[model samples]
Target: MAREKKYREAVNWKKELRLFPGYLILLIWISFTFVLLGWVLLASFSTTKEIFSNKLLASGLHFENYVKAWINSDVAGIFRNSLVYSIIACSLLIVICAPAAYVLSRFIFPGNKLIQTGFVSAMGVPVVMIVLPLFGIVANLGILNHVLSNGMLLIFLYIGINIPYTTIFLMTFFGNLSRAFEEAAAIDGCPPTKTFWLIMLPMAQPGIITVTIFNFINIWNEYFISLIFANSDQLRPIAVGLYSMINSMKYTGDWAGMFAAVVIVFLPTFILYIFLSEKIIAGVTGGGVKG
Candidate 1:
């Protein structure tokens, strides 16, 4: 009886320990994330006076700062530019990357492995390394130093940069799909193109949606490329626009306005993540886990 009780007690203790570690880790992570986010939120409502005085926690919130930032500053225009560029880039990425991934995943050819290897290699190249060459190319094309040029060139650049990862992810999804469906469709007199469009593409919806969301976020948040290529205030995205606002602090001394600008810049991505987070998670996790 004593030996049996001891074994049962030990097992219960182990189970309790397992629960404690997981809970502790989760609590720590949650606390860290919340603390960081809380700082940003607090800063967004604080003025330069509050910040410099080191009494931000005791200062009153300045909600009017958002209005001034939005209407008076160039923040609205910047957001518009970001929206336009991101929309164009994401749309092109979806149209081009989807079909390419499907073909690459489905077809067997002499250079198939070589093509895939090249894509994987491209993924390893850092954005900083590519930026200089891209700038030179844009300059050679005589579109450098123009805002519209920046927006137009960035669409193509973002698409190209994101394509490798998008293709690889969709390739895994496409490859895991059963061949039986395509074979059956072919046996029913469907052409390869028709089979791909009518059958396979619909089934790949989850992966496509997931990739599109990722592309959207990437294009929306991209700063380095836009900063390098775009020169004018009208063509600046939120990232560049926010930087400009902060820089203007030297002249205007409006810390509240800058904080408001930060909040405005952060809103779109936060709202998007809040609404589509479940779908994004499901789409990514569901793709090809079986195969």
Candidate 2:
């Protein structure tokens, strides 16, 4: 028994020694991230000159940086644009992808495998490939800068880009769902559509919420598409707006305000990950485990 125990302890000790390098790497990364975020936060409260001069604030913090960014730079409007675009895109993605995933998962039909393969392929395709053609089509339509038209077009583009991945993500969840619920619904004379809406979907809440959170963060931070499609100052989402602000900073020299704007843009995603990280992990892993 003593020999066995010593062998097990030796094995564990070797394992820990093997993982020491990974632990050191993780610690270094965490320390670097903390320092970077702290510096940004501190700089946002310092004056523009102080930021450029590598001097910490000896004077009191300036709240005016936030005010200037919010009002003077139209960060308020840009923030609203991001919120609207993200919410609309995520809502539409769920509405369109959910039923399609359900049908694909539950029903056996012709070309089902082909459709699934197509969605998988779509997820792998880079956005750069389709941007030029999409831009040309939008330009030719003369809907370039109008808020309503641009907003609608952006929503459609977001939906089209996201649907394939969302559908495939949900398909795994749906495939893992037990058919007993459907059988029970059918036995109770519930229609197929009703069964999907009322029974299976409710049970798949975890996966749905996870996917929605991901889509929200993705659409919120999306830059290339928004930059190309909604280039107008009035319609710029936070990502593009911030990029414009960074460019303007060369002339305006409002480094404090720029850092403040970056913090504002980063806060929502940070808050989301902080609060729902466990749920995201569970949702992503649950489908594979359930199947």
Candidate 3:
């Protein structure tokens, strides 16, 4: 027994040794990411000259950098715009996708598979291919800069673009849900739609929150479509506004302020991941666990 235990210990050691290289690579990657983020945080408080001179933190923490980035650089308005876009887009996405996904997962209708295939295939199509035609449609509709109308248009664009991904994500979650709940609801005289709304959706909360966080982050940082549709400074989201700031950095030379803006733009997603990462993991794994 002692000899057999020794042999098994040796075998486990060899398996760990085999994985050492992968472990080393992951450690290096994580170290690099931390170092990069640390540098950005340090730079956000340092002066541009100090940053360029490799003297990070020499300026002794300049809070004014954030002020300049937020007010002088006009990031506050852009941040608000991004907030509006993300909120409306995510809300509309759930309203539209949840039911559609539940139906697709639960019901058998004509062309259902075709619709599913179309949504999956749409995910692969490049945005550049559709942007130009979409631009033309928006232009011909004569609703370019009408503030509220344009805002709604941008929200619609966000919903339209993200619908495929959200639908597919929710479809998997709904498909994994047990039909026992639905049968129970039916026995209680609940209608199909009510059963879905009251029963399935509550059970799918993890997936919905996971997908909402994803869509919020995506729409908040989205640039290309927003750039094409919302070119005006007042309508620009953080992504587009940041690009403009970078362009003007040549004249402004406020690298510290730029880094501050970057941090501000990145904070929401970072905090979200820090808090809800477990929910995200649960959502992705919950479907697979049952199957």
Candidate 4:
């Protein structure tokens, strides 16, 4: 009973009364999220009539909602497209950013700060400002009508827009790494490039995983760029494609089907966070130490 009382006061409301308001707000927010997601999950398996009546799951589980959404609705195509774009873009971002970040963080070359400042400034530029010029170039080049080029164009834009953020993020990770590793590698006759690739890069895995997750989520959910450049139906990613699907579903009145589609779209990021959340926190607050 003494232990139980002590445990009950784990929050120490008497001593931390000032924090009670913040905790209350966080609790409210969590409650709201749980209620919202619960409703969506329930609605996905319910019939349209059940959803309208707020009597979800009254009729047994309707697995066909997912089947219909996945097949008849063409969620599979857009899902595949988003997956491919995100994976390729994330891989390329790491490859390009890792070396650039290593150089920027470790070396004191001429105009290094200027280059970093340029990247930081680039991130501040609104996408709307450049969209028109980008469209004009692509349209004039006549690649927008070609399916293969159109897909490639989307990937290129994703990589271009993301470079600044990726480089900046990884630079923090690389900067946190110990120079002792490099010195030791040099003593052992390892080339700088080999040291970076074989030793330093792997040591920065936490930060890389964290930043890659961010990049993947960004590319996966990107709507405006894909909408502008994905000129064809087949080239569309999940965001724009899901928008069109939902709009069409509005006409069909398939409420359950729409919710099922939403859940499908939400799964990848949800699962990713579920698994790598610890790594993300570690990346943000962690660094290598010198012996």
Candidate 5:
């Protein structure tokens, strides 16, 4: 028993030693992160004078900062716009990518490898290269002048830009699934489409969730695209709108309000991570990892 205990301890020591570097880096990262976010949160509640003096929240909890930011900056309009864009873009990406991924992963068809390779290649192409010609074409079409058409165009761009990454990600996860599920579904007289819709998609939930969260964050925090496309203040998303507000803040000197705006803008992604962190971990580590 003593020898057995010693062997176990020695093994654990070696394992811990091997992991020490990762643990140390994570600890440092977490510590710095908490300090920064903590300051930001407190600064949001503080007066501009207090923030500069390094005495945050000394004036008591001023919820008014949030109110001022929300109202004065017209955050509600931009927030709603971002929400609409993200929700629509994410839903469409899933609908379009999931089936494409499944078909690519499961079937042996002509051009399958080519299609996969194309998607892989597309992922490497930077958005900057294509934005110019695309923007020029849209301007020629004369639809960018209209609000609904402009919004639809933005959604289309988001969906098109994300398709390769989303498809590849879900394709890998779909590939990880055992053929047993499909086999069993076939034996039960289920069609391939039905089997995929009912069985395979649910099985790929973790990956779907993770990818959706990523797409949501990307679309929500998207700056350059929205800055270029959203010509009207009403159509502007939070990222572009926030930039405009910050620029105005330089003259208005509403530092507290700006911090509050930052917090409000950051809330959605933060809530997403908090709620779905487990799924993200599972999705990242579980990706059809074959033995």
Candidate 6:
């Protein structure tokens, strides 16, 4: 009995030792992250005077900064623009990418492998390399200087850029699915379109959700492309809008307001991640598992 107890204790010690590094790393990461976020939160409530005086760390919390940001700053308009762009771009991406991915996954055709390889290769090409050509095309189309025109152009650009990756990801996901189900549908006299829509689509939900979430986040957070394309304040997404706000600080000196704007910019994506994290995880895991 004593020897058995000693063996159990040895196993417990080994387990504890194994966990120690992970615990330490987690603790360190959490501590640093909390400190950084806490600093930003505190800064949002602090006045310029408090910041310059180095008294921001000691100042009492001021909740009114958020109200000022929402009411007086360009943040409200920026938020609206971002929401609109993200919704449109994400919806269009999913609609286009889903059907395309579904076709690519199930169909066998001449040049299919070549097309797939082309897409995968395109993924490695930097956006900057194509930006000038894209700009020239939009300019030739007479849309570069207009806000709504440029916004729509950017949406199309995002769709094109993201499609390759989304297609490949969904192809891999759909490829792993069993042929038995599709075969059964065909034997039941179901048409190809009907089989895809009613059977394969339902099964591919996880992959669809995963791709949509990724695209939504990427488009929402995108700054450089929006900046290059969008020429007006009204068209600027939150990312570029926030940068403009900070740049305007030289003249306005609205540090507190900028911080509040930052918080507002961060809120939507944060809320989305919190809510959709479970769905994203499930989608990725389901796609990874083979039948």
Q: What is the lDDT for 4 in model 1?
A: 100
Q: How many backbone clashes does candidate 2 have?
A: 0
Q: Candidate 3: global Cα-lDDT?
A: 0.87
**Residue 139 of model 4: what lDDT?**
98
lDDT of 3 by residue, 1-291 (tens): 999999999999999999999999999999999999989999999999899999998859998999998998888998899998899899889999999999999999999999999888888888998999888988888768587777788899999999988998889989989999999989999999888888899998878888898789889878889888984678888899888887897588888998999898898888888998887667556532210
Candidate lDDT scores, in order, read 0.79, 0.87, 0.87, 0.89, 0.89, 0.80
Model 6 clashing residue pairs (backbone): none
**True-structure Cα RMSD, model 5:** 3.7
Best by TM-score: 4
Candidate 4: tens digits of C-alpha lDDT, residues 32-74? 9999988998899999999998899999899899999999999
lDDT of 1 at 290: 15
Off by over 4 Å in 5: 1-28, 281-291
Per-residue accuracy of model 6 over 1-291 as CA lDDT, tens digit each: 999999999999999899999999999999998888776778888887786776884678777788888777768888888888778877787677777777887889988888888888887887889899888888898996777788788778777778787777788778878999989999999998889878887897777778778777878888878888887778888899888787886578878777878888888878888899887667556543211
Clash totals, every prediction: 0, 0, 0, 0, 0, 0
Cα lDDT over the full model 1: 0.79
Steric clash pairs (candidate 4): none
Candidate 2: where is the Cα deviation over 4 Å?
Answer: 1-22, 281-291
Q: Tens digits of per-residue lDDT for model 5 on 1-291?
A: 999999999999999999999999999999999999889999999999999899999979989999888887888888999999999999999999999999999999999999988888887887798889988999999868999999998899888888888898899889989999999999999999999999999998877888888788889988888888876778999999999998998799989999899999999999988988887667556553211
Residues 1-291 of candidate 2 have per-residue lDDT tens digits of 999999999999999999999999999999999999999989988898898889868577988989999999889999998898999899889889999999999899998999988888887788999999999999899888677898899889988888887898888889889999899999999999988888898988877998898888889988888888995788888999999888897687778999999988998898998999997677657643211
